[model samples]
Target chain A: MELIKVTIDNKVVEVEKGTTILGAAKKVNVDIPTLCHFKLHDMNIENKPGGCRICVVEVDGRKNLAPACATDCTEGMVIKSHSVRVINARKTVMELILSDHPFECLVCAKSGTCDLQSLAQQLGIRKIHFEGKKSSYRLDTSPSIIREMNKCIMCRRCEMMCNKVQTVGALSAINRGFDSVVSTAFEMNLKNSTCTYCGQCVSVCPTGALTEVDDTARIIRALADPSKTVIVQTAPAVRVALGEEFGMEPGTIVTGKMVAALRRIGFDQVFDTDFAADLTIMEEGSELLNRLGKHLAGDKTVKLPMLTSCCPAWVNFFEKQFPDMLDIPSTAKSPQQMFGAIAKTYLADKMGIKREDLVVVSVMPCLAKKYEAQRDEFKTNGNPDVDFSISTRELAHLIKQTIRDFDSLPDEDFDRPMGESTGAGVIFGTTGGVIEAAVRSAYELHTHKKLPRLNFEELRGLEGIREATIDFDGLPIKIGIAHGLGNARKLLEDIRAGRSHFHAIEIMSCPGGCIGGGGQPLHHGHSSIIKARQAAIYKEDAGKAIRKSHENPDIIKLYDEFLGTPLGEKSHHLLHTEYFNRKK
Target chain B: MATTEIVLKEKQVQQIKDICKQFNNESGELINVLHKTQSLFGYLPSEVQVVIAQELNMSLAKVFGVVTFYSYFTMTPRGEHPIDVCMGTACYVRGAEKVLEEFKRQLKIEVGETTLDGKFSINSLRCVGACGLAPVVIVGDKTYGAVTSADVKNILKEYENK
Candidate 1:
């Protein structure tokens, strides 16, 4: 890498050749405000279209201002990032954007967190002089996402995230110039498109154009209903990231605070989705062992390299993209759905609550869980097992609306039976977690021996795709892990071509798994936040007394009392699900 | 814009698949494939775009994006005698809007809509590099030079009885 010296705002800095002016300016602590330029370091995802000229900077000897994000630094290049001329140009560009944008900040879902809103404030844009006919489009509301394109600034961040990162090509910049907007095929409903409802687009959107469907209103109504017994289940990933909404540092573990807040918010019972994650490990692990045993016995009928179905987005991805390989994934329901099923059935019976009267709500780190809760297979007699699901961000809003001084709240424990979970279950929040959890339980169950080591550090990281081989008492179990649908596509194509060598493959639609899930607090294009969340998940896992799922006393008792055994008739009815080929 | 649900014929689907195979089904050749498909089918409807998308192994949204970005590829079915009024700078200066309004008045249909008899449809296009002709009106394969609002009736008369 060749280094070049550049002067930005009278501060000299050295950067590699081909480094953008924005990159060189950052080394000298010079802030160049941007709207369209977004990068997720370590994830290899960037959206630098240079379409929004808000990052324009004055350059020596140049006739016109250059976009700092796209302009490369050269030797002895002099740049003025905050010069009056550059600031005036950036303000004009921002004013033009605001002129076309809707003035609904008072009611907008992204009022405080909107990048566009903050940029306007930062630029001191009190009024727009270039106001004209604002482009308007039909508001599209899907089960998991809402598309309010009226607020779109055409930054193309969502388009880049949808196509370049997730590879779920449900959105594209259609039409031309003035009329261009990111939309599905023929401007159709998102439910009808190839969208997996992964919410990766919503995660990257800088404006209110894309957002998770606000299910918090529905949840509040359910909680206010006295006739209904509302129970809330918090997913593992939510524990590590929920505190960020309350001004805590990223990866701050707020499990106890969250439970206490939920209790204050009027929930009759607060449980842990990690418990069902343990339940999933037992059922999915048995299924994996069963399939592996049959494949080793030369049974060509059994499907090798079973995929983990813990992610609803990954499930939807395969159902739409790889319809033929539906049978390859484990039939176990996701931890969210598993919790709902057990809560409506075993827990409801134990507490003497009627099935119809019991309301099961989940706090998940995914938008797909909102769609997953409403899936037909998870319903009985037009009533869903899970009444509804809310994202970790929604949970934070609810806490803010009900509790005061959340940071100073005393630590509280979860309600019995369905609340106790093992370390294996807690680790399901991060990448490589589901597979690692399955291995811990599957190894002991298959060999009928106590494992020497607990943590399989080989199966963890921030890599998009990872492969690890764990020795199960002489049986080398090959495992493949892929986060982000694009990387999952590579593994799926290899499997489709009969080239995959692994025995099990775990796929999460979002990058960095559930810790970096679309419904969590936005990382604002920071990959370090995801890494911190992943580390916090492992920290929570290591602190638990029982690291293996089978060792969880409540999970053991649930199987002994009500479920009978893993993969048994009762467990299959409650814990398993089938996939559909939604190719069209 | 309202679009009616359309189902392509079995043979029409096969034709699209063949055209995609000719282009090696490369997603990069989407524009070329769409042009060829539109030429064969007269227009790129949603049904035809779906077949092309499947053959190319690309998302329908992507194929639709390409089809919509260019003015040449249309989703609606064109009339037997499609009328295109050049709305370029040169043509606009030479009473192109009046010529377009006259055609729309005679056809009893809007710019993108076809006549009830399916004989004529109107569309406004950019420059056709026929600046010397100024206001040019194209009907089917015939081009009328320096066309006026009065010439609109004559152009419709030529398409009639054919």
Candidate 2:
């Protein structure tokens, strides 16, 4: 790595040869606000990547203002970080981005905290000179987040975050020129496509263009419906990330308090997605072992590489984009779906109540969860499984609206029975959570011996890809874990190419797993982003005494009395699902 | 890009069921059947509205009503080649508008019309998601971002050639 000399505001700073002016400036704390940039991600440079003109900075003596975020700071390069020319150019960029923006921030789900809106205010460009040419497209309310391109600034951050980081091509610059709109394939409704509502797009959105549709009030109304008993469930990822909304630390253990807060908000019962996560492990693990056993016995008809179906977004991607791989989707329902499925049947039958009277609502860290609730196969009790799945952001909005002081909501505990979950169940919230949970069970199942250490450190980290080689029985079992969809796409393609020797792969649609879910609470431009989200998950997992799913008595009781067995006929009918074959 | 693959469920389907119930299960209203089925399926999927037409005792031409009359409906699957002609004010003033008409003429389909062979679908876009580059056309994954009438031949040829 050769260092190249570069000039910035007349200061001598040597830089990496290909480092951009903005990158070099960040080293010296010369702050340059950006709307089109993300952590470890870069904008897509399709046909010279222009038109955004953001990060535009004036290069000394160069007639054109260079986009600092995209341009390389060369040797002997004279650069002005905030010159009059640069400020004027940046002002124009801000104005252009806002020209198309709806400016509907107050009522918007991203109100008071949108990237584009905040940048416009900072730029002191108060007027909209360009009322952008509008498109005929409607909001794409796919299974995940909503797409309001009308408020889009064309920063392509979502495209970059989704395509580059996630490896899912859910969005792209659809039309061209001034009339263009950010869309998913021909201006189609999201419900019709295979979009996993990971809510990653919402995390990167600069404006209200991409947001979770505000369903907070709907949940509130459902809770108040007297006729409807709203049973609230939270995914393991939520407890670690929800604390960020209250200015508490990110990844902080807010589980007890989260359950406490939901009860305060008037829910009859609040449960954990981890309980269902355990059920998923039991079922998914059995499915994997069954397939593995059959494959070892040379049963070619059995599905190999039983793709984890915990992440609905990844499932949609597999079904819609790689339909041939549909056969391998784990029949076990996702934690959220399983929560609702069990709540209606197992819980309902136990309580001796009609399924219709129970309006099961789940609070999750995902947008595709909204789609998961609407799945055709989830009608195990002849109705929708989880009725309303509000995102983590939506829950934050609800708390902000009702709670007197969100930061001061005293810590509390989740309800018993369904709420109680083991560390293995809690790990389900993060990437590689399922694989770790399964490894514990698979090892015990194969060897008939209890493993000592619960922590599977090899499968944990921020890496885009992780692999592990564990000795299962006498055979070395290979496994791969891909967090973001982009990595999943590469792995799947390799599998399609018949080269990957791995037996099972754990894939999550979002980077950093569900804590980085699409529906997490919003934060300041970058200041309020808690760096401790990952540690929080592992820390909470460490706090629990029980780390294995099969060890969860609630899940065990559910299996012993109601479901009977993992992958059993009754369990398949109630807790499993099928996938459709579609285009890639 | 997932939108290009059109598959309708409950909502678009309600139209057919609603119309059937409207006619008191009359299998004789062939014209009504065509209109209802086409309107329901958003340009009939091959035998989807075809099956509906047969069940309703409706003629294929009548079924073609809801499909052709409304711009939303399509008969064959919309073309895999999406020819988006940007006619935003800037591009419209810059000859992009007339270029679009010429494209329809060359492709043998009107604006919002897909070619008979299902190879091309012509849609007049307000903007090509790229404002600076006026008069753009997106053919599948490739968008001639800053397009012009002069560039139409090259753009059309690429899709036609492919």
Candidate 3:
């Protein structure tokens, strides 16, 4: 590759050809503040519209200041990134952005985290000079997301994430000039559009325009009620990422501290979603084996390449985009729903509490879990099995509001019965984890023999799409895995065209699975944080004594004492769900 | 802007599909397809955009975005007779605003709206490159040059019979 030399702020640097001025400046340790420019370096996702002029820099011999993000660095070009002329222009642009923005930072959901707010602070903008009519619009609230378009800056990062990364195409830049805003067709509510509620758009938005619906208040109300028995369940991914909100390093395991904190917050009992993840393995694995047996017996009606139905957003995607193939995914309900069903039935009955009085709260690393909890199929009569589902970020906020010293809290253990889980359940937080967990138990059940190895390293990675073949006593089982919804679309197209050869497929709607979920602590366009969390999940899995779901004693005892068996009549009604056509 | 609900007939839906097929259903030809579809239906409503989106295999939001970005596209139906008043710089200096106000007062409807009888709809446009005819007003295909506020009543009388 060719090289070019440029001088930024009196510091000379050499960079590769076609490098942006911002890139060249970074090499010389020159900082140029920016907005509407986002990138996940390891994930190959970037949104560089350069519509914001906050990064404008003075170029020698050029009449106009150039935006550092979009301007290419030329050889022998002299640039001043922070000269008087450039600083004045950047401050003026900041004032213009704030002039039309609402001054509700004290109560805004994204006050401290908002990029626009931070840029104004960095530029020392105390007051606005140009005052005019501030654009206003109706606030839209859906089951999982809230859209406040009045605070939109038209950065288009959310638009890029929706259309380019996830391929859900639920939002676009509508109208022109001052009237333009990202919205669905006819400015319809998100619930009426093709939005899967994956929350990827919420993750990339620089302002409070997009956010997950806050459920912390409702959860606190349930906890305060004397008649309600509120129990909390934390997903495996939340443990690895929740520490970031408390000034801890990324991927710090806070399982024990989180449980202690929940107990301190007045929960009647604290459970783990990992236990339900093990139950999912039992149900999903049996379903897989049942289909494989029928397909091998020359049952032409059987559908091969069964899809995993653990991710709510993925389920919504196929239901909306590929409604004809709804029968192909496993009918087992997600781990969150399965836990809720059991909590409302078996757990409530065992503890002598009424079903309606028992409130099941889930702390998830997902935004879609909020929507999944409200699904009609998971409800009995008019009462939903899961009363409230809050994101990992909301949980952190609740902890800060209730507990004084979270870091100093002593280590604690989860309650008996539903808190026990195996290593396979803990791994369900990352990509390829659900299928790998299924294979661990499915292999032993199918062959009636002990497997030599436990770890299937080939199935795990950060790739968009992956394929692996595991030998179940010489019967090769081809498996496919896709993390992002865009990659899942490609795999679905292959299946529709009769080009698929795999026996099963696993799909996650988020980029790096639940660890990079939209409801997790904001990574600020950094994929390395997601990678760190992925490693932490595997580390927790390896540290456990029993690595297989079938070896969990509590799971076996529950099956023997309360439930009859996997895929039994009781299991079908409580642990399984049906899909609907949502294309219209 | 509030839009009344519009349900297209089966035949109208087929016509939109045929227009998309004429462009080979390519997403790049969305502008051309929209132009042809609008010519057939007089305006692009939400229902018709839904059909075009399905035929082109693109998101409805994307199609709507393109439609709203261009000023020529309209989501409301036009009347039998459309009246356009030039508001270009040349016409604005020649008392065009007064002429437009007279039409609004007489028609009892604002710009971009049709009369209750479906007779006439008013709109403002940029330069038609006819500066020589300052304050120009066009009703259908006939152009009126140097038109005044008093002439607005006569223009409505000519269209009342048609």
Worst 10 residues of 2 chain A by lDDT: A39-48
Candidate 3 docking quality: incorrect, acceptable, medium or high: medium
TM-scores for all candidates?
A: 0.98, 0.77, 0.97
Estimate, for each residue in B37-143, the C-alpha lDDT of model 2 and write its tens digit.
65444345644554554456433323433344433355545577877677778777777877887787788887766777878888765655576776666776776
- Residue A10 shift from truth in candidate 2, angstroms: 3.6
lDDT of 1 by residue, A1-584 (tens): 89999998888899999999998988889999999999999789999999999999999999999999999998999998888998889889998999889899999989888999999999999889896889989899989999999999889998898899888999989999889999999999999988998999999899999999888888889999999999999999999999999899998999999999999999999999999999999999999999999999999999989999999999999999899999999999999999999999999899998889999999999999989999999999988999889999888888878888999998999999999999999999998999999999999999999999988899999889999999999999999999999999999999999999999999998999999898999999989999999999999999999999999999999998999999999999999999999988
lDDT of each residue in A177-263, candidate 3, tens digit only: 889999998899999999999999999899999999999999888999999999989999999999999989998999999999999
Candidate 3 ranges beyond 4 A from true positions: B86-102, B129-137, B144-154
* Highest-scoring model, lDDT: 3
Q: State in Å the error of residue A211, model 1.
A: 1.1
Task: Tell me the lDDT of candidate 2.
Answer: 0.74
List DockQ for all candidates: 0.78, 0.04, 0.74
Write down the worst ten-residue block by lDDT for model 3 chain A: A38-47
**Each model's lDDT:** 0.92, 0.74, 0.92
- Per-candidate RMSD, Å: 1.4, 11.9, 1.8
TM-score of chain A of 1: 0.99
lDDT of 1 at A494: 97
Name the candidate, 2 or 3, with the larger TM-score value: 3
What's the lDDT of the predicted structure labeled candidate 1?
Answer: 0.92
Q: Where does model 2 sit among the CAPRI classes? A: incorrect
